[model samples]
Target: MSDYQVFIGGSAGSIAPVITILSSLPADFNLTITIVIHSGTDSKVSISEILANHSALTVIEIIDKEQFNPNTVYVAPSGYHLYVENKHHFSLSVDRKEYYSRPAINVTFSSAAEAFGEYCIAILLSGANEDGAEGLLKVKRHGGITIAQSPKSSQVDIMPQSAIDNRAANKILSPKEIISLLLEYNDLA
Candidate 1:
């Protein structure tokens, strides 16, 4: 299989959709998945654990300078910005928040677009702000595929809708539809 990476970003009301999509993916899915969601620094629950509960893929919080591995799910740690340093590794930063978010979707999406170029797939899910819009545009500019959750199907439409308005989305789909497309892309459907 080709070495493609998938980046998914979301905020308020996005956890359910993310879990739904992750749960639908098969265990052998070969692409690496990196996810960034708005999280409170004091939150007691681990997002990685939550994702692991829903996904057959190994899920872990990204560590600075860690190497990327396929079939694994990497979640951005709280209070830090996540970036793909290259196709093979990740880097974290303590930079000031963008859009009032530390692990901003824009940071991950833009960096992944640069690192993976055409081999990347960027997805924007439910959020209350316009964090991922410009990042999605960057991904599209770098020849990566950009997907946004359909506004009608989103819990909070601002994020995905912003991507649509920016003309960055190659496709707008619901969580279930996104899962089907992913499976089809990997020839698992």
Candidate 2:
């Protein structure tokens, strides 16, 4: 499997299929899944518990100065942008929002693109805006792997379309298949 960090971008219309996929990984899988999702109508939802409930993985709302771990998932908080301090640790800030969004997919992805370089993999799943396009561009420019759910399967098509339009994504598959690909990377690694 590839020794790359996987960054996922998805909508808040509901929890995403990609989340289900990431949560299903085998216990021994050697990877971390950092998800950047749109916050819901209320910022008080217990996303960590909700996601952790069915996942075979651990989930946490990332906070400043926390160490990261493999076989785990970090959910960016509802109103905070999640960022990396080192490849294996996390940081949070409310200093500003990017692309008019806090917990913006673009900000997190762009940082991962630069921090991990070729060791990063970015996936844009179901969502409504072009928020992830610039971030995915950063990934592509830095030689990171990029994936987008096929717009046909996306509940909302704009995000994936934007990535495709800019040639920022490397693969465009349905959410179900992304799990296998991520597992394949884990197996190879």
The lDDT leader among the candidates is 1
TM-score of each: 0.97, 0.92
Off by over 4 Å in 1: none
Best by TM-score: 1
- For residues 16-46, what per-residue lDDT tens digits would candidate 2 score against the true structure? 6755785578777777888888866465656
**Pairing residues by index, what is the TM-score of model 1?**
0.97
Deviation of model 1 at 124, angstroms: 0.1
Shift in Å, residue 137, candidate 2: 1.0
At residue 41, give the lDDT of candidate 2.
44
Model 2 TM-score on a 0 to 1 scale: 0.92
Please give the clash total of every predicted structure, in order.
0, 4
